[model samples]
Structures are given as structure tokens and as C-alpha cells.
Target: MALHFTDVEAALDHLLARLPAGLRVAAPLGLGKPHRLLNALYARVEADPSRPLHLYTALSLDPPSPGKGLQARFLGPFLARHFGEDFPRLAYVQAMKRDALPAHIEVEEFYLQSGALLDSAQTQRRYASLNYTHVAAALAARQVHLITQKVAREPGGDRLSFSCNTDLTADTVDAHLARGLPRPLLVAEIDPQLPWLGGSAVAPDGFFDVVIDPPGPHPSLFGLPRQPVGDADYAIGLYASTLVRDGGTLQIGIGALADALCHALVLRHTDNARYRQVLAALDPDLESHPAVRDSGGLGPFEVGLYGCSEMINEGFKRLVETGVIRRKVVDDAALMRRLADGTANLGDHARLERDGEYLHGAFYLGSPDFYAWLRDLPEVQCRAIGMRRIGEVNQLYGGDEGLERLQRRDARFFNSCMMATALGAAVSDALEDGRVVSGVGGQYNFVAMAHALPDARSVLMLRSTREAHGRSESNVRWNYGHATIPRHLRDLYVDEYGIADLRHASDEDCVVAMAGIADARWQAGLLDAAKAARKLRGDFAAPPRWQHNTPQRLGQSLAPFRRDGTLPDYPLGSDFTAVEQRLVRALAWLQASTATTSGKLRIAWQALTATPGRDDEALRRMDLHAGAGAGTWFQARLLGLALARTARDH
Candidate 1:
């Protein structure tokens, strides 16, 4: 029987009394972290400098800090509304940000919340570079003293569920046991809001040494507001969608691009004529591309798809609701093989029901709506989604390689990258200067697995261009210093332009394919570099079709669909209201405009000439009023111009 407590301080006292002085604690990443308990522990350690503390984790969830000026004013109310006003933030994270950690205290992570700790030198220095599947082993190696996470249970139920995270807890505990190490103290904080899940997510009896079921009024789960998808995102998504084979497997990362891809997949299944129209508008000859012709299709999914991903984001949920993610995979290898070969009897519904699952994911973090959907799912429907361990979801050698291979047939592992080289290296996780943007979680595993599997391909998606210092720079380059996925493992690369099939292609062919997908402005320079390096033919000229790969052209192609609701900005539902959505666009425009000196001057000029004409609602939402101050007036005018510009462009 686990010791139960109603107060976090009592649990802290118990931990302090039992654990050693040099406390090494492990917490689950993302939504699974027990913030209240962790906060209390951190407070205790901070107050007592004699006790050294070491915290190991990844993707520590921190609510967005409302910064100064217009951005802060706009976000403050929204943050409080979305994440409760009393939401518990990790004290160690704040201490690290302020560079005020005690001399003996340290915080290390496998993955930093995407660029959150970029400027925090302490965090960057203590960062651990490990794959998602390797985190458990790393924890065991560190000989962590405690493993604590928030868990779920039904009202007055004895059983516990790992809920949003089944990523590493069991694996870490098992790894420790296998290594003949002492069993780490297991602690669980019961949060009523967490959805009760089954499969590998259910914990065995007496799994925890301590359980803290605090009194009511629990804080809301941190919800990631849906990002607005741009024209480039839709173009990239449409191209990527064509590469999905019917009845294939999908593994997508999270973000606007992933959402766009899911939206495109839904459209492909529901309104395929519009899908083809948008594809044609993007590239008239897209269907004839070898990657599409050989490995992809531009048709509705008759057999649907099975999802196997590390992060079960909101996109997967939408895909499921749209009937695009209905292909069920059973755990039995023999059954899977028989089903694949049409040898198994279709009439045996009982066995199928016992073993079938439409999706297998390690963890989930998404909007509140997604959580509710999972919480309210019928038992039968809930069983269709299996929350497994990261090792099982990310790799092939875990439990049953044969079963995994059968289940992941025609797999397309889709992930986003920051940049890629013309020769086919991907820069996904870090910068050239050895600064980690986000640690390599599972991109490499999925990419390598794609190669190990006979009929699978890893699709690395990136926008063709990004705005840096208010100027468009090509993401496809001739060379880059760092690579998360090197050229040797190069596979499918997708941009707004098209997909580059570099699987087994030679240097020259890879150059051509990569250049075909580069922005039109940068294509010539990339090819010139390739030619100078003697990697490409000097006589080869850029294709005429590739020259039209520009944002203007992409916007023109997708504008009609965006108007007709075929391609929505928030394809998944949004927490942001209509006015807030408009403000988000305007604020994005303002940020981009202020990125360069010339752009800043232009914005200043616009502010001087512009008037805050009939946008009272947007102004009131931001709390900007007439005659507040010069700074306020200038901000109002600048925002007015931005709103007008975005509106006109749309």
C-alpha cells in the first residue's frame, strides 16, 4: 500500500526524511510533471543550501512569460485565462533563467522547450543530448533517487493511469531493476483532470511509494494554442500529403506544419477534388514527380492510415475524427501478417477487438479540447488508441521487431527541420555555434528506422525560406556546420516547392532534387556552389518549372481555398477568440517588420502617416486608447498599419 497524503508539504517532509542528502530526482517531461510537488521540493532545496539537488528532465513546461510593451499587454489576460492564474511554474526553471541557482543545485534536460532556454547559459551547459528512446537508460545511469509524475484515476478507483505520459516512467524503473540498482522512490500526484488511459499506460498495483491527492480546484492542464498556418505551410503540407500511401503508417511531429499536413490529409479524404485543385495550383506537374508517382498517391484513403508517433498531437485527433486515421493494427505479429496477406478470416471480430489499436503513441500534449475529447471517449473507442512507451513507439528493436515491421508497413515518418544542405544533410536540433535549439528527441531514430524497414521513408519537412533580419533566406543551403540527420541517412525532403527524393540518389542527382525545391531566388546560388564543388554538371540549367517557386505564387494558388474554408488558418480549433486571432496576425506582421533597420524605418513612417481608423474592438482588446501617451499612440498607429496590411494581403 502506498502512503497517501493530502498536503504537498507532508509528502516533501517524507521525501526529505527518507532520501539522502545528495538528492537526484527525475520528473517526466511535458504534461506528466507534478508541478505542485516539484515546486515544494525545489523550495525546500533552495532554502537549505546544505542539501545538493540534481533534477533531470526534458521539455519542462513553463507558461509563456508576458514580456514588456504591447506583446505583454496582449498576452497577460490570455495566459491567465488559458492556463489558470494560480498555475504552478517550476521554481528551478525560474532560478535557472535568472542565473540564481544555489552553487550545489543543478538542472539538466534531454530536450529544452523549443528555444526556451536559449539564453540561459546554465541550462545550455547542463543540457543532455539524448534520443527520446535513450532517456530511460540515461536516468538509470545517473542512478536517480526519485521518479515522480502526475497520474490519473477514476472517482474512488484504485487503479492508476499514466495518462498524458507513458513515455519513460516504466522504462526507467525497469532499466534500474535490470541494472541491479536500488528501486527509485516512486511518487504520484493525482490530478483529476488527467484522462484515464489503458494499454501500457495503466500502472500495476503498489507502483508508487507515495501518492499525493491534493484537495480540489486543481490547476488547468497547460494547453498549446493552435498556431495559424500560413500559405507556405499549406503548400508544404499538400506536397507532403501526396506522398502518403493509402493504408500506410504516419509519424508526425507537432507544430503548425504538422497541423497543416493533418488538415491536408483530412481534405484529401473528404474533398479530394479541392485537394487536387490546390495541388495543381501549387505545381501543375506535381503528380508526375518521381517521388509522388513511385511512393505517393493523390487520392482518398480507402483503407485509411494507422498512426505511430512519439507525440500524439491534436493533428492526430483531427485525423481520427475525419476517418483518415482508421487503419487498425493488432499487437500479434502472426495475425498482422495473415491480415496483410488476406489469409486471416475477416469474420473473427472478437480476436480483432481484443488486439486492435488504431494508434500507438508515447505521450500527448495539445489543446484543452483534445484532452476533453480523450477524456470523454467511449471505452471501445478509447481502447483503439494505445499509449505505449517511447522505446516501443520510436524504435524497431524494442520488444518485437517482426511485429513492429508488420505494423509500420509503408511508414512515412514526417518531422520538421530548421535547415537542410543541398547535398541532403538536415539541421533540425541545433545551431552551428554549438547552441542547442531543441535537443534531438526522436528524429534520428525514426529516420534510421525508415531505412531499416524495407518500404518506409522519412519525410523531413522545412519551409523553403525564412525571414531573417526582415529578408527572406533559403532554408536549403550548399553547406551547414551541424546536422542532426547527416547526408548518409538523407531521405525525402519537402519544402513549399516540392519533395526531393534523395533516398539512394547520387551526389549530382541529390543536388538537382534539392535545388528543385529551393526558393527560386536561391536556386541559382545553390546550383552555382554545387557546380563549383564539381558535384553538379556545369552545363546543367535550372528547370523552368522550379523558377516559379515563390511565396507570391504560393499565396496566389492557395488564397482561393483559404477564402472558401478549404484551407483554414486554424484548421484545428483554437483557444484564441476572433479578435485575438486578428491580433496575432497583426502582431506577427509587426514583429517581422521590425526585424531590419529599413523595415523598422518603414514601420515608423507608416505609424506617422497612419490613423487608427475603425478598429475599436482590436484596440480595446489590447487596451490601447487615444491620447494615452506618445508611446501608446505610436503603438496604436503601428498596430493599425499592421492590421490593415494583413487584412489587405488576405
Candidate 2:
């Protein structure tokens, strides 16, 4: 029998009364975060101010607002206005930023919500960057003292499902039991609406110490902020799409670039003609790029891919619905080997393996639409998309590497990073001075897994340059103080301009390839730096084959038809209406221009000096006019600037 309480306050009173001070609470990351319980605990600590409560979590959502400046001002309002309002303020974020919590409350995070956005020194000092594969190592070392999770009520049964957070939960429980540690206090907040993911999410009735189903929706559901795709991102995604061979394993991360890559893959699999057109517009000489020429293809997958991601995001759901993510992976090592060797097929495989899943993910966080999709899925289809322990999905050294290799053969762990050296060393987390941007989540594990697998490779993606603190900085540089994926584990690197296949290339070639993909303005400095370090020939110059490697040239060649609206912000398509798209584009331009010193002035100059003209279609679509209202002034200004750029281009 289990004690159930409708009042969270009463439940907390009963639970905390029994537990001593210095309670160690471990919760799930992302969507699985139990905000209500955490808030209650924080409130209790706030009242007492002496209880030493410890928190262990990763990639938990922070408040929408972080950092300071024009970009923050602009992006903050834009986000609050649309897309994300259901997300609530985080107790962890508040404590990290302002010291709002008790002094004894220590937060040890495996990953952060958005590390790059973090500017708090205290938050940086509090972070612990752990490899996703070795999370259990940290757990074992720390001796997990307590565990609480958000779970879904079982259908027609008195039980709970681990639901959205099976990633760390199952494995944590298994590892905890194996270590023979004293059984910690276990509790669950039951949300009946949460999907009952049957594979490993199912749990017996007596799993928790107590259950609470409070009557109102006090803890808002966490949702991932939807990132809009852009031209550079689309081009980068197009290049990456070509590298994903038919019937290979894919491991894509989250964010705009990942979404763009997903869109490009969809186009390749469903609409190859348009994909080629966009590719030609983005990389005219892709055929000249040797790595791409040797391994890349512009064709659709005759046999589709199997997703093996630590985070199964909204993109994977879309891929699954489109039939692009269709390869089933079995749990048994022998079955996987047979399937890999082509001796057994999904249709005729042993009946026992029928329960084999199409994708294996650690956890997920996406939009409200994505959660709705998950909630509405039938039981059988729900089983097709399974969640597993992070220890299993994140590492290659553990159990069934053979089966993992069979399932994730030709694995391409496509991930994003902040910076990398020309030699392929990467910095996915933290800055040179140890300011934590985002904690190293699973990129390290996937990179090592790729290196260990015979046919696997890691594909690292980033914009060649990113605007930070109002300055454009090169993401591909000669060297950096920190590295998430060191030079030894280097593989493929992609930017908007092109792909740098550095897997087996020499040091000099690595420099050349990195320079090839760098933003044209940053290339000379990078090459010069590499030479200063004696990594490249003293008199090195881009070979004759690299003559057309400037941004201006790339702009004209790779995306020649961008102005004609052939390459809209949403290249594949979007749910946003035409009016919304137009508005979003204008906002994007304004935001980018305002972020830097020269941007607003540049836009003003273009609006003044360039030919005064009209884009009636755009104005009509966005419902803005020359003399509507005060609201129209902003739109009108943006339209004029866009038109000015168009006049100059023509």
C-alpha cells in the first residue's frame, strides 16, 4: 500500500519530518525536472535557513532571462511574447544568480540549461563537468543519498511509469542497488497526464516512499525554446545532410542547427531535387571537396537510419513520423550481430525481437506540440520509441559494445561545439578561464565512442563565427585553453561555408581544411596563427584549389537565390504563417543589427543612402503599411532596411 496525498504541503510535512537535515536530493534533468517538489523543498529550506540540502541534476531549465545587453533585451521580450510562457522560473537559477537560497544548499550539476548564457561567477564555480558515460562513476563516488522523480500513473494498475526521464532513473537505481549503498528515500509526484512509456518506464506499486497528486497544475510544464532556422544554418545543415550515408546510425543534438539538419535530411530523403538545388546554391564546388566527393552523396536513403541519441528531441519525432528514422535495434547482442551482418532482417527476424525499438534515447525536451505527440501516441507505437539508462546509451566501453556497434554502426555523433582548433581539438563546454558555458553532457562520450568504433565518426557542427559580447568571434581558431574533444579524438568538422573532413588528414591538411570552412574574414588570421605555432609551412598559402574561399564569393555562389525567396529562413518549411515568418525575419534582422556597434548604424545608412523602394507583398503579408499605427513604425523601418539591401544586391 502507498500513502497518497492531494496536498503537496501535507505530503512535504510528513516526508521532511522523518528525514534529517543535509538531505541529498537527486532529480531528473530537462523535461523530467520536478519543479513543484523542488520549489517546496526550497521553501522549507528558506524558512529554516539551517538545513543543508544538496541537489544533484543536469541540464535543468533556467529562467528565460540571463545575461545583460541589447541582445538580451530584444531576445528576452521576443521569447516571452511567443513560443514559451508555460515554463516557470527555476529555484536553481534564482539561487545561482542571486544567492537566494540557504548557504548550505549546494547544487552539483552534470549539465546546465544553457551554459553560454551563464554569466554568474557563483554558477560557474558551482558547475561540475562530467562525461555522460561516466555519470554513474560520479553517482557511485558521491553515494546518492536520496532520489525523487516525476512519474505517470499506470493504466488500470496501481503503479507508476518513469515516463519522460528513464535516462538517469533506471540506471541510477540499478547502479545504486549494485553498489549495496543504504537504500535512500524514494518519492514520486504523480502526474496522470504523463505518458506511460512501457519499455523500462514501468514500475511496481511499492517503488516510492510516498505519492502526491496535487489538485492544480502549479508546476508549469517545461518546454524547449524553439529556435528559428537561418540561411547560414541551412547551408551548414545541407552539407551535414550529404554526409549521413543511407542506413547509418545518427546521433544529432538539439538547437537550431540540429533542426536545420533535420529539415535538410527530410528534404534529401523525401525531396532530393530541392535538396540538390539548395546544396548547389550553398556549395557549388562540393564535388571538389575531397572528403565530401569520396564519401558524400546527394541521394535519398533507400534504407533509412536508426537514431541513437542521448536526447531524442522533437526532430527525431518528426523523422520517425516521416519514416526517415526506421531501423529497429534489438537489445540482445546476438540478434544485433545477425541483423548487422545482414543474416536477419526486421521483417523476418525472430518473434522475440519484435519488441525491439527503432530509437534509443536517454531523455527529451521539446515544444508543447512534441509533448502532446508523445502523450497521444498509442501503446504499441509508444513502445517503438524507447528510453533507456544514460549509462548504456552514452558509453561504448560498457556492456554489449558488440551489440552497440551492430546497432550504431557507421555511427555519426553529430554535435555542436563552441570552438575548435584547426587541428580538430574542440571546446564544447566552458571557456579558457573555466567559466562554464554548458557542462560537458554527452559529446565526450559520443566522440570517444566514434573513435573506438571501426566505422564510426563524430561530426562536430558550429557556425564559423558567432557574435558574443557584441563581437564576432571565430569558432574555428588555431588553439584554445580548454578542449571537450581533443585533437586525438578529432573527426569531421562542419560550418556554414563547408565541411572539413579531418578524420585521417595530416596536421597541415587539418589546418587547410579548417581554414577552408572558416568564415572567409577569419581564415587568414587562423592560417597565420597556425604558421606562427609552426604547425603549418612558414610560407603556406591556400592551394590553387581553394581560390574561391571568401564569404563574399560563398554568398554569391552557395546561396545565389536567397534574395528571390527560394531560401526562406525555414528552408524545408515551418508551422509559422507567412505573416509570422515575415515578422520573424524582420525581428531577426533588427536583433542581429542591434547586437553590434556597427549594425544599427549600418542599417540606418543602408535605409538612407540606398534607393527608397517598397516590398508591397512583404508589407501586405505582415499586415504593416506605410502609415498604419505606432506598431507599424518598427515593421516599416525593418522593411525599408531589407529593401535597401535588396536594391544594393541587384
Candidate 3:
């Protein structure tokens, strides 16, 4: 039987007494962290320098703390409302931010929350670059002997569930046991709010060594707010959606682009005529593209799709609710093969219901509404979403390759990247100067799996341009120093303009295809570089048809749908109120305008001469009043101008 305690400090005292010095601990990433117990342990180690502690984890959750400024005035109240005042933050992350960590302690993570730790030199130095599947083995190699996680159980039940995270804990324990080493100490912190899931997420009562059952009113689970989608995102999503065949498998990551893709898929299923109309406006010849002809279509999904992704966010929930992700896959290989070949009869319906799952994921993190949906699911609906191990979800070489291949037929792995070279290399995780923007999570595994599978393709989405210092820079470069996915594994690439099918294509052909999707201003320069390198003919020039790849063209094509309410900014719902949503747009505009000297001067001049009172509601939301101070007066005026600009553009 597990040793259960109700007080976190008492549990910490017991752990310190039982474990050895120089303790090495591993915890689950994202929402599965046992915050109370970990915070207690961290406090103990921080107070006594003689006791050393090392923590290994990824994606530490922290509530938004917008510093003192106009931004803070706007976001302070909203953060309190969304994340709750009692949301548990990782103590180590706060210490690292202030450079207050003790010399004897160390914190290492395989992945950082995207762009969260970019300026923390201490964190960047200790960052571990490992794929999601390889994290367990890496932790085992480091002799991680203690595992702590948050778990869920019935009101008075004995069984435990890993809840939102079944990604690495099981694999870590198994890796140590397989090496003939002693099993690591397992600790669980019970949280009533976590949903109890079955399948591989269940654990027996005796599986844990210590269980902390805190009193009522537990801390809130971390929730990621939904991002607004833009014209470029919708255009990219529209092109990517055309490449999904009916009854195919889908894999997507999180962010605005992924949400946009989900919206496009839902549109394709529900209002296919309007979907096609929008697609035609974006790209008239998209249907004739070879990639679309060979592996994609432009019709409603009669058989629906099966989702197999590493992370299940709100997009997947929306897809499931809309019946766009209803293709069920069973665990038995023979049954799956029979069903695929139409040899199985309706008599097997009972067996299918017992073993079928429409979606398989390793972990999940999304908004609070998504959590409630999971918590309130009916038993049968809950069973259909099987949470498995990271190894099974990310790779094909797991123990049951044959069954996985059958389940993942016609797979289209869609992911996002920051930049791509003209010769087909992707820069997703890091900058050229070796600064880690984000660690490589699972992009490489899916790309490799797409190559191993016979009928699968990996599609990498990129925005054609990004704003840097108030000027537009092409994301498709002629050459780059860093690469996450190299040219040898080059596959399909998509942007707002179109798709570039580079699988098995020549270097020259790859350059031309990449140029076709690049911003029109940079296409000629890209081709010129290829010609100078002797990779293309001296007479080569970009086709006249590609010259219209501009943001104006994309916005014009999608503006009508946006006006008619067919396409929306927050299709998946937002936590921000109506006034706050307007503020978000205006703040984004202000940030972009302040990125350069000339733009800053222009904005300052406009603010000095701007008329006020038109944005009183927005000003009141941000708590900005007249004559508070010179800074406040200037901020109020600048914000009013930004609001006016965004409103006019809308």
C-alpha cells in the first residue's frame, strides 16, 4: 500500500529523509506537474545550501506577469480572471528569471515553453535538445530515481489516472526497470479537477510510494488562451486543407496556424461550396497541383478522419465535436486489416465498440473549456480518446509496427516552421547564432515516419514574410546556418501563396518550387542567388504568375468571407471579452509600429495630433484616464490612434 499524506510539507519531510543527497528528480511536463509537492521540495533545497537538488522536466507552466507599463495595465486584470489568482507557478522558473537560484541547485529541461526562456542564459545553458520519444531514455541515462506527477481518481476509488499527461513517466520507469536497475520512487499528488481517463493512463493503488491528497479547493490547471487567426493563417490553412483526403490520418501542432487549419477542415466538411470558392480565390490552379492531385482532394469527407497527434489541443476537440474526426481504429491488427479490406461484417460491432478509439494522443493542453469537456465526457466518448505513450504516438518502430502502419494510412503530418532555405531545409527550433527559441519536440519523428510509410507526406507550413525592424523579411532564404529538417528529407512546403512539392525533386527544381511560394519581392533575389551558384540556368527568371504573391492579394481574397462571418478571428472561442479583443488588435499594431526608428517617430507625431474620446471604452478597459501623468497622457493618445487605425482597416 502507498504511504498517503494530506500535508505537502509532511510529504516533503518524508521524501528528504528517505532519498539520498544530490537528489535527481524527474517530473511530467505541462499540466501534469505536481506543483504543491515540488514547491515544498524546492523551498527545502533553497534554504539549505548543503542539500543539492536537480530537476529535469519540460514546458514549465507560469501565469502571465505583464510588467509595469500600458501593457500591464491592460493585461493585469485579465490575467487574474483567466488564470485565477491561486494558479500554481513553478518556483524554479521564477528564481531563474530573477537570477536568484542557489549555486548548488540546477534545473534542466528538454523543451522550453515557446520563446519563454530565450533571454535566460542559465536556462539556455542547461537546455537538453532531445526528441519527444527520446526524453525517457535520456532521463534514465541521467539516473533519475524519483518521479513526481499530478494524478486523478474517483471520489473514493483506489485506481489512479495520469490525466492530461501519459507522455514520459511510464516510459521512464520502464527504461530503468529494463536495465535490471531498481524501480524509481513514484509519487502522486491527487487533484480533484483532473479528468480520470482509461486505456494506458490507469495505474494501480500500489504503483505509487507516496500520495499527497491536499485539502479541498486545489489550484487551477494551466490553460492556454486561444489565439486569433489572420488572413495569412487562413490562406495557408486553406491550401493545406485541400491536401487532406477523406478517411486519411491527421497530425497537427498548436498555435494560430493550427487553429486556422482546423477551421478550414471544418469548413470543408460543412460548407464545402464556400470552402472551394475561397480556395479558388486564393489559388485558381491549386486542384491541378501534382501534390493535390496525387495525395489530396477538394471534397467533403464522407468517411471522416482519424487523429494521431502527440499533443491534443482544443482544435482536436472541435474537430471531434463536428464529426470531422470520427474514423475509428481498433487495437487488433487482424481486425483492422479486415475492416480496411471490407471483409469484416456488422457482427463485429460489439468487438469494435470494445476496442475502437477515434483518436490517440500522448499529451494535451488547452483552454479551460477544453478541460471541462474532457471532465464531463460520457464513458463511451471518453474511451474513444485513447491516451498512449509518446513512443507509440511519435514513431513507427515501436513494438507493434504492423498495427501502427495499418492505423496510420494516408497520413498527412502538418507542422509549422520559422524559416526554410531555398534548397528545402527547415529552421524550426533555433536561430543561426545558436540561441534556442524552442527545442525540437517531435517534428523530426513525424517527418521521418512520413518517409517510412508508403503513402504519407509531411507538410511544413511557413508564412511567406515576417516583420523585423518594421520591414518585411522573406522567410524563405537562399541559405541558413541552422536546420532542424535537412534538404535530404525535404517534403511539401506551404505558405500563403501555394504549395511546393519537393519530395524526390532535383536541387534546381526545389529552388524553383520554393521561390514560387516566397514573397514576390524576394523571388527574383532567390533565383538570382541560385543562378550565381550554378544551381539554376543564367536565363532563369520567376514566372510572371508568381509575381502576385502579396499580402494584399491574400487579404482581398478572404475579406469578403470575413465580412460575411463565414471566417472569424476566434473560431475556437476566446477567453478575452469584446473590448479586450479590440485592445489585442490595437496593441499588436502599436508593437509593430514601435519596432523601428522611423515608425516610432511617425507614431509619436500622430499621437500628438490625434483626437481622443472615440476610444473611451478601450481606454477605460486599460484604466487609462486623462491627465494622470505625462506618460499616461502619451500612452492614451497613442492607443487611441492605434485603435482608430485597426478599426479603419477592419
Candidate 4:
């Protein structure tokens, strides 16, 4: 039976009591449901009068959640009510956005809209879709509760299987006081798929107040607001989708590229249904399996596609509902049952839909529809894709025996890349300092898997250019930079410009192929550079036909589908609302701090102004002067793209 707590509060109380006075909690960040239970614990602690508590959360403030409103008013009071002056709340927000607000737990606006996803039945279903229903139980797990890490053995003393490396904040604490818990300890079992990093270690075997294990937590499910799909997005999607050959395991990351790719694939399944007929002719016994039935033989099968990701957001949920997502095979019935019921292994299954087939994640963020679904994930309906095995290649988990079973199955690995070179060098991660911007987080693993499977190939999606300062520029070409995936490992590269088959292409051929799809305006520049640097070889050279980024060509290629549909990059959704946009603009205008302040003001200004015009041609022509910062123009660019597409479609 799954470990049960009376309610969220009971679970938190259980955890709080076990924690040593100075211990810290490092939990998953972002649109996952981990925050829900976390907030509940904070609220409970906030209500307590005698115990002064210090709470800190790692979140980037620029992407403010609608949930923040509820947190400030409801949670802030609970903390103040319980701990009085003793409560100290700190939020660690990245200082990237110029207009980012200072972190505080208190409510500044009495009428600020609460950031909580609306509570409703539909929300429950959507949440269930992404597998966020069992967050409460997952936190109760032994491995999860304890923050464990791989630490070098301390040269002496009792060969510690696990040792408290440091507090959650990595502060040194009195070892005696730190050794607060007794032996035969309670460990909060965690999902192994979670991003592993050094530090924040938990105690090993002993040191338990009580050991509680709920199934692995589920991922967040978010729904995109009805928005228009741009030609650029559709084009990219079409190119990316072509890489998935009927039967390969798939992994799609967040963003428009992910949405576009998935959406386009869905379209292919409908428009070119017979392309997958080979799978239809297979035996009914194999076909009867949910996992097998879902493959729908659009391409050849390697291992078939098993969706393994850190996020269980709405896009994945859509795949499941549409029968595009299939069930995974497990040997044990009890495990499957637990997985279905929202209870299973932290390292194994996520929340139980049934034991072995559980869905799991650390947290969630989404619309009420998504939230509702999460609350009631039923067996046979939901599957949690945990983060623990996030980066592991299929071979590592299943081993040679499992590989043999999967050998016949070709898994096409679909992942996003930040940049794809003219020479077919694909960079998915940071090239500078080898300091990973995002952990190798499954990209390398999946890529390796793609190489291992004969039928498998990695599809790397590249946007030709991103709109900046109200102007389009090539994302395909830039000055010297390192590649995340070097030329040797290059496979398939996709862009709004087109698709480039890079695997066996010569360097010159690769450049010609990649440049063929680059923004028309940049093709000459790329070609000039390639020829000048002696990079061009053989008969490969830029052709004259690739001379312009004309709307006519893009139109013909993408064929203006429904405007109001999901795209890939902003796949799950964006929180920017019309009202919120206005407020942000107002906030930006009122704050006259510096170039940074004006830059933020510009984003809202352009978005609001641009939304009114069709074709967004006016907005596109409007120059924006934003100072250096990350994701500075996301809101404006997205709005402009949506507007342009909407106008064109209508």
C-alpha cells in the first residue's frame, strides 16, 4: 500500500520534525508540482507561533508565476502568523532580467492576482495528464527526503555509506548538531532521474525520525493559450518531424521547437497515414499492447519511442491522450499497480497509475485544466516519465540483455540544439569553459543511443534566426564558437530554412547543405566566409537560388495551417497575459531607473503596440533598444510572432 498522510500538511509536519535545526532542502525548480507540496509545508510552518523558520527557494524572478500572488498573501501570512518576527523568507532569483523584482515572501499588492493554477475539475484532468497528482507521497519517500550526493569517503570513521556534506545552502554546520538524527535512519527516497549535482548530501542508513515513502512525484503539465503558429515555427517543425522515422524512442525538450515538431508529426500521421502501414501489418498480439499500438508505423522502428524527460508537461500529455504515447512494458504486476496508484520507487517508477507503470517528477506548473488532470491520474491513463533516468542511454538502464531486446527496435532520438553549423557541427550545450549551461541532461545520452541503434538518428532543430530589436537575424551563423556536438557526431539538422543531412556529408557538403537552409539574407555571408576560409571543398558551393528570405517560399513550404495552435519552443505555455502585459508595461514605464529599465519598458511597449497590428510588419520594423540580458525580448517576440501569423492566416 502507498504511504498515506492525512493531508499535505501532515506530510510537511512529518518532514519538518525530522530535519535537524540547520538542515536545508534543495528541491527541483520550475513548472513541476514540487512547489505545491513545498508551499504547503511553508504555509504550515508559517502558521506555527513558537518556531521561527527560515525558508529559501531557488527560482528565477523574471518569469513570475501567477501563483506568486497566492504564495505572498496566503503563505506569507501563515509564516508571519506562526513564526512572527522569527520567520525569515528569502527567494533566490536570478538577476538576469533588468526589471526583476526584489525577492520577498510578503505581499506588496493586496489585490494581486494569485499565481495558483485555477482549481477545477478540468485542471485536475490536465494535471493528471502530466502526472502531478502524487506530489504529496513522493516527498515522503526515504531517498527523496534525504539530500544525498556522491562524496569521497572521509578517510576515517565508519565508512559512511552516506554523509551530510553540507546544508541545503551548503553552509557548514556544527557536526554534532548536524549529527542530530539517530541511526537506522529514515531516508526520503528520491527519483534518480532528477538532475544530480555535487553537495547537499543527506545522511546514509541511520538518522531517522520516521521513514515515509510515497510514489515518485510527477512532472508539471501546462497548456498553451490559444495562439497562432508562425510560418517560421511551422517550417521548422516540418523539417524537424521528418527526422523521426517510424519506430524510434523520442525525447523533446521545452519550447516552440518541441511543440512545432510534435504538432507537425501529428499532422503527418493524419495527412500521410499510410506511411506507417508497415506497423499495421504486424501481429495483433504485439499491436494490442498500448505502447506498441501507439507507435503507428510512420517510420521504421528501432526501440520504438519511450518518452523520457524531466518535464511531464501538456505536450506529452497531448501525445498520451492522442494515443501517440504508449505504455512501457514492466515485468512486475505489483510495480505496475503501484505506479498506477501514485506510489512506486523513487529511482524506479513515478506516482502510481499502477505500480510499475507510475509517472513521477519533482514539480509542476500549468493551467487549471492541466492541474485538474494531475489530481486524478488513473491507472491505464497516466504515465510518469521520471527525471532520474533523464540522461541515461537505453543501454545503461536495460543493459546488454535489454539492448538485445531493443536492438531490433530503432529509436530515433529527437532533441533540440542551440546551434547547428554550416559544417554540421551541432551545439546543444555551452561551448565556453565546458561549464554546462544546462547539465548534459539526457542530450548526450540520447544522442549516444541514437548512434548505437542502426535505425536511430538524432534530429537537431535549429531556428534560422531569432527576431531581435524588431529585426530578424541569423541564428544559423555567428562568429567563432565551440559546438556541443562536434562535426563527427552530427546527424540531422533542421531549420526554418530547411533540413540538412549531416551524418556522412563532407565538410563542404555539410556547409552547403546547412547553408542551403540558412536565412536567405545570411546565405551569402556564410558562403563568403566558407569560401574565404578555404572551408569549401569539392564541388560544394552556395547556389544562386538561395538568395532571399521571401514570404512566398515560406508560405509554400509551411502552407499556412491553423493560426491558433501550439508551436514547439513555447511548447507547454507562456504566462504572459494581456492584462499582465499591460501591467508589466505600466510597471516598466513608471520605473525610470536606467537603460535596463527602459529596455523592459520597451518589451511591453512593443508587445502591446504590436498586438494591435496585423502582419506585425509595423512591429517587426520597429527597432528595439534592449540592453544585454537573457530572455529580454521573449514576451515581445512571441507576441509579435503570434500577431504576424494570426494576421496572415485570417
Per-candidate TM equals 0.98, 0.88, 0.98, 0.55
Give stretches of model 2 more than 4 Å off. 66-87, 155-157, 218-220, 284-290, 293-296, 345-353, 544-547, 557-568, 571-580, 596-650
lDDT of 4 by residue, 250-311 (tens): 56665566677666666555445432221222111323432223323333322224554434
lDDT head-to-head 2 vs 4, winner: 2
Candidate 1 local lDDT, residue 472? 85
Cα lDDT tens digits, model 1, 28-83, are 99999999998898888887878999999999989888898889978999999999
When 1 and 2 are scored with lDDT, the better candidate is 1
List model 2 lDDT by residue over 268-363, tens digit each: 888788778877766566656765656556788787888888888888987888878887777788777666667866554754346768888877
Q: Please report how far candidate 2 places residue 246 from its true position, in Å.
A: 1.4
Top candidate when judged by lDDT against the true structure:
1
Off by over 4 Å in 4: 1-25, 29-62, 65-90, 94-228, 273-306, 331-368, 383-388, 391-408, 431-439, 469-471, 538-540, 548-552, 556-560, 563-650
Ranking by TM-score: 1, 3, 2, 4
